[model samples]
Target: MQRSEMPSINTQERLLAWALVLVCVALLFAQAPHGGDFYWSDSPRHALNGVFVMDLAKAMPFDDPAGYAYRYYAQYPALTILFYPPLFYAISAPFYAVLGVSHETALLVVALHYLALGLGCWRLARFWLPAAPSLAFAALVLWLPEVAFWGRQVMLEVPAFAFLVWSTVAVVAYLRGAPPRWLYLGAALLVLGMYTKISVAYMGVVYAALIAQRDGWAMLRNRHHWWVAALALVGLLPLAVLTLKFGQANLQSVTGVADAVASRTSWQGWVWYLQQIPSQAGWPLTALGLAGAVMAAWRRMPGLGFWWLGFGVGYLFFSSIDLKEARHSVFLLPSVTFFAVLLLHTLVPPRVGHGAVAALALLVLATAGLTVWTRPVFYVQGYARAAAEVARLAPRDSTVMFSGYRDGSFVFNMRALEGRRDLHVMRADKLLLGVAVRRELGVEQKGLTEGEIADALNANGVHYVVMQPGFWADLEAMQRFERVMSSDQFEEVARISTPANHKAHETELVIYRNKGAVTPRRRGIDIELKIINRRISAD
Candidate 1:
């Protein structure tokens, strides 16, 4: 308890914190996402968002980003840029420009966020738990299945939640009397998190409640809370306006689209996330986490307001949303780890000392680490090669029509072309079909008849017909288009094969050469945002 002893302990803690960070780096290098790491349907879209930014910067159209973005989307129809927030892309753009657009380059950004997740969680845990338990719990949480799975992929959730964690930690530190300036730091991080993904905005309610309760009328009367309002106007107001335009589907997922799939009133929305914890995080951590949550709430622990309120409010907020996915609940991991470490510290007999807890945690981490040390799955990357072939053989400024569930992947791969940026990719489903796939199928009348499809194809100067058999086979229009591709108008020139995608139908990408004359033309894009709850009448 001596003041002099505090320096040595603080130094040791600092060393341990950085040491844990170094371990994170080692983990990234040792088990980097390989073998279709970016093959998940949404993975490539995340990568391409950054590519769009990188490509835009190269064109130097700072004054005309909207025009540039439309051109970029015209070239590749599968970008989810504005649908998601712009921070992740904005941050990754420079790296993409420096490293060049590849999955490896995109994944490097994920690795950086992964390190932040570890260090941020550890820092947050230090506020609630002792040094040993804090470091151990921080490392232990990352070993959770969902955390590791998300952090490994080029996805927005990990980075988004990491920023939220840092923000939460900073706000709690300020509440604990760290300094008034922590408010600014916390506000800045929260804005980054919100700009990374709008979902992070939900937890703002929790932070607001804490600040209101803590500061009372004096917070407003004294201007202690002005930073958050200032940040919201500057950072969030514009994002909110832009998202209204580009992220309409994303916004609807909270209510109409969300309820259509899993009603907000349904137990499925409320329980699905909790059900995932046992499997997503092992049973041991689940039990410990539950116990710690109870303990923290009962004791009214130091950081209980932030951690427990986050858990309770986060659970209700996410569960009430009509759109439900396990990833949406990843923000709850910090609370889970906090409570687990709380009980872990409690169970550690003082006689045995905290060092024993540290050793035990390391032991558990070492064993659990073995399980995630090697990421499995062989290469499922034929889409990139198909893109190369399309860029190489297709006439300059021509269109390539791709029909498959992974149109985003192909669009992403095509964006990497060196000299053929003029070539455009049109998704067959969007071009020829006006059907709803989310919640339930609402098949409108035929999207396009055989003759209409052919006319559209010719009008758009589609010189290459690439498709995976069985894709949209149920649709009458695709069937009609299939007949068109099968007829004498197009000949099967090359079969670009790739690994079967997601264990679905054999995805040997069949590329057909159109016998008709190649006409280069510009045309308006037909964008079918998926969360449209209404049916589209056949044209």
Candidate 2:
């Protein structure tokens, strides 16, 4: 190849990269929920929090009187504030104000972030791949089900990733000697990423490793390195303060309360993530990524070692954590995709022609399409209709108990979306009931009998109960449910049944009204009766 031809090749590649990025952005927008609603149990809650932050920013009351009200057993009886980094909410707040705090508005904000993610991916890939292939690779990474599906939601996963990738690109530019300003910019972005989600802190580790690899101990002598560190510390101070204040509650929120128990350091967790990669990233991309990583490592490619390190360290760190989730490892997706693009570029020999390169690009697009096609469209369906029904049927200022696996969805939809702030939707699980009893009723009873629970519900002014079929799956819960049904203190009100779909579990939300109690609060009577029965049985 002539040296003069290199400029033409580079220009053409740059143009193709931009063109591919635009196409990916268009596809992402197309898949987003424009007019229709897509449901996630967590999204409405996050959306509500964003609106709350927006209100606070505007000097309005942070709490909405007409919003769904639930006692935060973890805190006080307050509007639900998802214990997450506030950056996503802070960013989405203005959109909430302009869009009237609807799901569509939240999704639109996410769509914008998705576009930003595409651009970030392109810039990050350009460090390794030529301009044209880098653009296609960016589109492929953006189109991955792991990215696209979450990118459309109100969750912080994609938003944090957007910052993390850009930070990565800026860091690369700095290391390559563009300017010291890029290093500072990278620090700021890392801080921003941490604000969005703490998981992005892994990038800091990757960045340090990259520096250590490039300059060894000598990199520490650079004044610019010290400046970046100081800037990052300053940026991360707010998050550190939040961590100190919230402590374990914030950790529990991110890892999930249930995961605190279920997650363990096991190969099973590692295997689970490994299995998700092929589906999440697509088989073709995963294979190519593996090949590229091996090739890059075999040749000891400069500045490319961080990609492998990032993936390896990220996978190990996340998988080793007690709380394991597929999404927790999503930070590695871009690294994997980057390596995959490199392998694809290497596959076509200079003599083998551009057709081979085009075929590889086509293969990536096809795999992305397959992934999108197979991925579930909604996280939880039929929630909007059920929420509307609750809003319509239930009396204003009445408490509605939700006894279901997906109670969060009901709580979010009824309160967050429908603006049914007058209704207090309580999850009727034993753990929740225990907390409610202590907080709302000033009772500290544990292991309350079914009758005792029923009495407490009546005394607490809980007017309606909504139970799904899955709620009755537990033997004890089912027994209690039957007892509640047979009691004269409650009457069935409404039954909402939604057929199982590709994305959502089949649900039967049964609403029951509390019939006025014929007797005084059972308080300690059931416990006494149980003690007496125990003695009698022993005799």
Candidate 3:
């Protein structure tokens, strides 16, 4: 505690902190070259949202979402629509301001935003741990295969996760009894997080509860802090209105999403989640997290305790839903990261703190290096190329269908080709996909037969069917078509030959000619005439 020792202590801490931060920055920048994975529906959708926002800012571009497709423009969740448009648009502003909205330039700008967000996570981690330890933790969370898997690729996660960490840091600082300014800052970050993604709203409550548990809930009754809470609510009002107004358009549709997610009560859902845990967190990390959760609860650390609860609920929701996806659980990543770091921090003895820090830093470096080595960034580029190819091969006004929502590949392709004037695209129904399978397999499924596919194709004016056969080949249509467009589902259909990797069979891409306008099979009178005609023909 002598003045002489104080300087050395300060110097050592400063040296360690800067060293870790530099490592974190290096890892993020290394992965920067391989931008987003656009093949997935959500990734490009988000990229385009940023693109469109900037496009409008340029000179009020008329390419509205409504004119694109029903679901394309349709209201679903307010997370990406209202919040990201403005958030990422602002992020993209400098790039667009300089680059002038060219597709390549715009995407490069978005990529920079990803880099900035990654660095922000690194900075936040430093506040919780010493610079070296924090950077190591940031690297682990940022470079996790799933983090790169979900993070850089777009979706509400990256921005949402960034704000989640920001708010958490604020709350922790406040709990550590920092100045009121820190609490206000936490409130502001929480507001932005909620605006970007609503699930984080629950996080604010959890954080507030943690604070109350620490300083006593009686403090919450004070008047001065009311403004902090008020400002948070005020910032979120625009998104709240958007959700309400959009949901009002079709009450059933809005409820259906939540209902659909809730309806998947199968035991298989649980099993699927259990199966995913090892791949996502890695067994070692998951075990560490569980230990961390138990230790926090045992010590009655409410911040960590409440976080554990939120993480558990979030993961359960992730597993049970019909829409089970890695992206849905993106909000939970911060909690997982926090607990993992907390466990390491708590379990390791202070005498060997330097060793623990070094070990963690090494682990992060190894994992991030592996992730970059194996990560899939080509998916997005593939999609962008496929969209361009589709614009070329098929005739003008050729109606194209992508069998599944393979990363909204078709949607982005269509969007990229806005001025074509000759092309239209629609998603093929699952039943039609089944029909393709039945035809190819020569297996009779009750509704999805060859006749159904013929009818559906005709009805939609589908002149060309563009698909990554390997991904959706199991569908009867892909089996029936026997035309391989892009060989791998993960690979782009354009400019690349399908790899030798065959499904049980190969589904080929076919351009079926539409001989005539498709007429709907009307009910009642039409059914009666069809029945009579069949009888007359038999007689």
Q: For every model shown, what is its TM-score relative to the native structure?
A: 0.88, 0.81, 0.65
**Mind sharing the TM-score for model 3?**
0.65
Ranking by TM-score: 1, 2, 3
What's the lDDT of the predicted structure labeled candidate 2? 0.65
**Ten consecutive residues with minimal summed lDDT in candidate 3?**
530-539
Off by over 4 Å in 1: 1-12, 25-37, 62-64, 258-261, 297-303, 350-379, 435-447, 500-502, 522-539
After superposition, the stretches of candidate 2 with alpha carbons farther than 4 Å from their true spots are 1-19, 29-40, 58-82, 247-272, 350-353, 417-419, 430-445, 470-478, 503-505, 517-539
- Which whole-number lDDT from 0 to 100 does residue 33 have in model 3? 25
Model 3 misplaced regions, further than 4 Å? 1-37, 58-86, 89-128, 245-277, 292-323, 339-354, 369-383, 393-407, 417-539
lDDT against the true structure, each candidate: 0.73, 0.65, 0.52
Put down candidate 1 lDDT per residue, 1-539, tens digits, no spaces.
00111112377787888788768656754565442334567788888889888877778987867667766776787777777888999999999788777787877887788778778877877665667777777777667767676676788888887898899778777777667688778888888998987778777788788877786777777565775677566878889887886676776767657235467777766787888776566677777789878876687655367776787898888888887777678888767766777786776676664544864475457535643643222235577778888788898888899998777778878887657778888778777666554314355544677777787788888999789877768877778888989888789978877764246444578898888755666556545556433222211
List model 2 lDDT by residue over 1-539, tens digit each: 00111112366665666677677767666766433244555666666677667756675434742222122221112233434678888888888777676777877777777777878887777666666677777788777877777777777888888898899878777777667798788888989988888877877888888777777899889998898898788878888876655444445434544444335445565666777898788887888878888898898776566677788888776765666556777888877788877777777665656754685678677867876787645654565567676667766666666676565456556645435665655556542333321132222235567777787676645677777755434455455665775588788877877544343555566767788653322221111111111111100
Candidate 2 lDDT for residue 228 = 84
Candidate that scores best on TM-score: 1
lDDT of 3 by residue, 20-90 (tens): 54555455544442322244445555655655555446545357443322223321111134423246545
Model 1, global lDDT? 0.73
